[model samples]
Target: MAWSYRKRIKLIPGVHLNLSKSGISTSIGVRGASITVGKSGTFLNTSLPVLGLHNRQRLSGPEPPSDPTSSPSDRILPLNQSRGNIFSSDVQEITSQNMQGVKEVLLLAHQQRKELNSDLLKTKASLGGSKVKLVISYLLIYGLIKRSIPEQIKSDIESQKEAIAQLQQAVEDSYVAFEIDFDQELKERYQKLVDSFIQLTGCAKIWDVTGAHHQDRKTTRSSASRLVEKREVRFSLKSLPEVKLGFDALCFQNANGADLYIYPSFVIMYSSKTNFAVIGLDELSLSQSYVRFVERDAIPRDTKIIDKTWAKVNKNGSPDKRFKGNHQIPVVRYGELILNTTTGLNEQYQLSNYEFTEAFGNAFRDYQAAIRGTKQR
Candidate 1:
């Protein structure tokens, strides 16, 4: 006869086992008594019919159809009491396996997280470094521009200074060789020419008829007919490549301080053959004496050449009643030459427009030379 015992084990929530022994026979089955192991361990029984029957009872139960949908917790809860009867070592082994699996999964997840964090930190540092580089590059460019600005300004200022120096030198050179006393000669020559022209023309004069009839007629006639004449002329003399005489003298005031004069440095003479003739003086011969005359007397007197012309008076009035005398002739002062004629006398001269044009052209040509490259002193 043999004896048998049954045992049950629970592994986690989803697994279970039932073990039975009878004589020399052994078997294992699930909760529904479907045997998965049979005759494998101590289940061969030749005697002990009671133990065999008990074993058979332990193995026998209602047929268990496969339950593909049964949950592991549903299977496990029914075997909770049976688990106590199983080997503690086997239960501990199953629990350890589950715990090891969980730990491995958690550790893998933790390793992945640490790797991600490291990658994020590296990316952030790279971005920060790039930003720092960009800032430094901008600062370097700005510094270069700031350093260049002063040099550019200095170059511009230096160029301007050079231009100013050149202009100053040109002015000084133009005046360097000029003579001091040339204006005096010009004044004397101009006066002589004026006197000669006036006498040669034998122009009419205005006399007060009242003076002829007065008891003091002798003195009055003598004084009135004395023919006080004042003449002034100014012209430029810069067109001629070469000039013989320079400005001689500038007559600025008369003995009575009522007359003013300006010396001519240019002249134009009209003749039947040439039609127009131009004379020019050397700029190198213009004197400080002439400048003095302008400064001291002539400029202060504010005398103008137009005031001396016969055109100052009316043609229709008697000598005594009019503000200016009758017998007033019209004089066209062109450059240094005085064109003296009565209003109708110019018609007889038959001077062509081309002749006047040529004379004015020549005068302007010389005038340009005197002013060019020269400053007013």
Candidate 2:
């Protein structure tokens, strides 16, 4: 009988494999192996040596030393597409199947990871060059995680902008005006305005926007009644310097105290230097705030409105005088006694919810759409 010798077989144009006993072992390497040279060209896996895949050797001499200085891990190996550190005919067959989409790459990478962990638990893997393949698998997974992230985020943001524009227009179409007598109809209108303001601004309470730390109404009355009189309702975005201001006073925690020209159906707000008004309107009413317009714009930033002649004065200049039997409260107040929404407003700059909403909505809608449009791309 003749002794048989295994010969290297050419599988394809560039891929060749040795059928010898040790060839398969060296080709795959063990798990947790160090990273090796990148694959040739753009092929998924690195090349191996049956075909002398990499012509350039790391050694400088014609022959390798009897005792090599390099560790097994230091010797680079080909990256296998499968796990188990053994690339058999089965693995090759599985990879040949039609595969597409993002998860395909991730699934194979994750499978290989599980195989490596299984080997670790069983202590069957020395992992030397195998780690290099694991690294490639993880790299594929990492790439998939970030896929379409930036674009999807941009799409979500763009959708929100359109929602805002439509919401503003809807509010404008719903605005209703009122005169002196504050009735249930007026109250409903006021409530709707408050609702839309809360929904769009994300301020669940006045403090969320105003940063007011008052716990109860008594504390609120003491702190907030005089708040607008002081500079608490000033253009400063928030009561606390640490917090950012909202788009308008309605969004502020102390919406009643904010230095804005408020009304039952709408409020007009603007920067100190600009004549343009940013109007907040009732989504339930379709008109102007006719009862009266507040004129804080005419009042100085730190001025106070004296409605009652308090007999007592504190060091802080607050009058503690209560209304007596003969001496009644002042004709006007912006507090609980009345539903007046015109305090501190700029009457001269007042506009019906009708006039302002359409214009403001039109102008702002385009600007927002354009801004988000740039982000979408």
Candidate 3:
């Protein structure tokens, strides 16, 4: 009766026994049994297995039945809201990182595109500049070729020294031949020659030979009367006075009725004893007043006025002195007077006194001599 080493325990819905001996202790509970013995009397309890354990005493009266349609797995745990939220956050982070990477790539691509575009523009600009330079060079070369080649050829052609010299000499000889003494007889001869040349060349329509005007009637009358009286008086005198003709002794008349009574082309202050006539081609009468009488060692070509004057006096005695006034004499070949006139019909029509004179030499004896040569030919 001193406590036998036996104990009874109830575990969940089952009963079991636990025993201890020799100063042993034991305990029983509804869930499990515990035992202790001697100095090592530590009681140990064992939990009942939760599976297939049912106790009527612990059951609450009439527990509600589970729905047959509900799945046991569905009821195993409630929705893990925090887990879902954590997953969503992780997904969002991953997506954001991908988007960021995409944005960076796009930015880099855009920058690359801009750089490429800039490089393209620069390359295009360089090409355009080169093209422009090439074009300019081509134009310059073309211009040089167009302008220089012909001029060089012409220079080469004209560089024949012997030919140029001969031409110059010929021009000089022709000019000298045209130079003539200024005299009234020469004037009349020149007029006749002009008329004859016009007729010979069938250039009557082109050549103008009519004198523009005459000396004043009173002056002409006085001059004539004085000359007659002087001749008569000289016949009576023991010795004739030396009459020195002044520069103003000559007169000029144009086909346009313009009359110029002025000094002879040069002064002829000659005494009656001197049979030799001192002729002068007035250099002052040139179109350019300062023109040198000689051009390239040759007397410059006579102008038209000079030719007219020569035509007027070809058959007359040489004047003591010759002077050119405003008119120029043209260069006329001995036999080419009429031909020149015919050929230069347009020039004649458009003739100014200056141009005419410039074309011909002094208009006195030179002009007349040219005409006479033509007549002889």
What is the lDDT of every predicted structure here?
Answer: 0.24, 0.25, 0.24
Error of 2 at 291 (Å): 14
Report the Cα RMSD per candidate.
Answer: 61.6, 33.8, 66.0
Worst 10 residues of 2 by lDDT: 21-30
lDDT of 1 at 64: 23
Once superposed on the true structure, which residue ranges of model 3 sit more than 4 Å away at CA?
1-95, 142-377
- Kindly list the per-residue Cα lDDT of model 1 for residues 1-377, writing each as its tens digit: 11111211111111111221110111212132111111122132323221111111121212221222333222321111232221111211221211232222223333433443453354345445545544564576863556554344344344333333332332222110112232343334345544433332232211111111112323332211112122222222222111112433222111111111122432222221112222222111111000000111122121222312222222322233334453343222111111111110010011112223234323322332332322222
- For model 1, state the Cα shift of residue 124 in Å: 58
Provide the lDDT at 64 for model 3: 22
- Candidate 2 lDDT over 1-377, as tens digits, reads 11111111111111111221111100111122121211111122234432222221111112111121223223222212232121112211211111111112223233433443343333212222234433554577752566454344344334433333332333232211112223443334444544443342321111112111212424332322221111222112222111111222342222322233333322333222212132222211111111121233343222234444222333353544452432322211211000111112211111122223223323322222221222111
Best by lDDT: 2
Candidate 3 RMSD to the correct structure: 66.0
Candidate 3 to truth, TM: 0.14
Query: By descending lDDT, how would the candidates be arranged?
Result: 2, 3, 1
The TM-score that candidate 1 achieves is 0.18
Per-residue C-alpha lDDT of model 3 across residues 1-377, encoded as one tens digit per residue: 01111111111122111111111111112343332211122234565332242221210112122222343222221111332110111211211211232222223333433443453354345445544544564576863656554344343333332233332332222110112243455456445434432232221112222211123424332111111000000000011112122212332222322222222222121222222122222211111111111111123233222232221122242211343432322332211111011111100111122332223332333442322222211
